[model samples]
Target: MALTKKGEFWYGTTSGDTQAELRSYSVANEHEASRFAASKCDCGCRTFALQSDEDAGVAIRTCTDCGQEHLMGDSADHLDDAAPETHECVCENEVFELMSGVSVTPGTHDVRWYYIGCRCVECNLVAVFADWPCDAGDAAAFLAKV
Candidate 1:
């Protein structure tokens, strides 16, 4: 199946209604998207702040309530291997909502690019943390893994 918009979130921009599109090739809706984003923190908080580095293919999720960070997604191993520094919002808060976008081949639906974004819950700042080229035959599975 082709990727579809599952949710919408503000991306801290004045351009194009200041919103970013969240698309999933597998998940069906916003609620499912939330579940796929991350699991509940040990502190019992389901919310988190997210950051990613495409160069390393690493995505980190920090618990909003307790500030515990977790390496997540299919590329998590890459992040673990690199051991690069993590990110923190300027407000010193570690809460964020996630959004995603993708580009695909016209007919084959092969994912050509993937982007992950986060909106800081505290300051409402939005950033595109990870975006990279993809050449997956199964777009849905690729997205789910990410």
Candidate 2:
């Protein structure tokens, strides 16, 4: 799977209805960003806001739609905004889970690396995420631990 998106993602609605389709979204304007930053839950029964990154731990919104409280994660590694040093495992058969936090260079603004727990769904191997080349079969050597 390739991680190919940047910035904050949110699910917005205009009916204040929990049944409304959770559209994949990002803040496109100042007004939208304000509403999102405020964690707006209902908009005259017209709109609702939810952060998509809330799951990966990168949200500042706290709107509870249908009794579910959505919050941003403080330990979240905001990789979407990170440099090209980090990338989503693009192998056709591998999937990755965002780990606890980001790996940054000590005393520097540079993000040296980011850790992602990866596994090859096809080969059933635990892949390592580092400076190594990105590939499915190429990482089999690191699978001995499993």
Candidate 3:
């Protein structure tokens, strides 16, 4: 079975089955909604259990197979969680350099590239493309902007 997202809900489907199983969460965020929906999954292969503490502003999900616990939610404001790390993005266009930073040590190089966000320009979205290693030339360009 595979889980695919459509709008706000994550729909689950099995290979041989023609029917799709559906689930949704009362929460707002897509990630949170997906996790919530995971709990409702019918597949017996993957099992999820949630442990929540409202007063502490924290919730965790445990995977029975891997024994790993993942944070489900925190009482913290949603702004930081949904806010984009970078404001400049090219949307569906080619990636354009917005800003970058770098640190060099003997044999080690640490580079951070801040690309434009993925949303359309008119949307006035604040997000960034995934960060990437800044090559020397790109690093030079990014540094000039900084």
Output the number of the TM-score-best candidate: 1
Question: Which is better, 2 or 3, measured by lDDT?
Answer: 3
Cα-based TM-score, every candidate: 0.55, 0.21, 0.23
| RMSD values, in order shown | 8.8, 19.1, 18.0
Instruction: Give the whole-model CA lDDT for all candidates, comma-separated.
Output: 0.53, 0.24, 0.27
* Ten-residue region with minimum lDDT total, candidate 1: 26-35
Q: On residues 74-113, what C-alpha lDDT tens digit does candidate 2 reach at each position? A: 3234536433222233344322221111223344333322
TM-score (C-alpha) between model 3 and the true structure:
0.23
Clashing pairs in 2: 14-46, 15-46, 59-72
Question: C-alpha displacement of 71 in model 3, angstroms?
Answer: 0.8
Model 3 CA deviation exceeding 4 Å by range: 1-45, 74-146
RMSD after Cα superposition, model 1? 8.8
lDDT of 3 by residue, 1-146 (tens): 45454454332333111111211111111211111012212223233333333333233334445656444322133223332221222233321212111333234332222221122223222222232222333333333322
The candidate, 1 or 3, that scores higher on lDDT is 1
- Model 1 global lDDT (CA atoms, 0 to 1): 0.53
TM-score of 2: 0.21
How should the candidates be ordered by lDDT, best one leading?
1, 3, 2
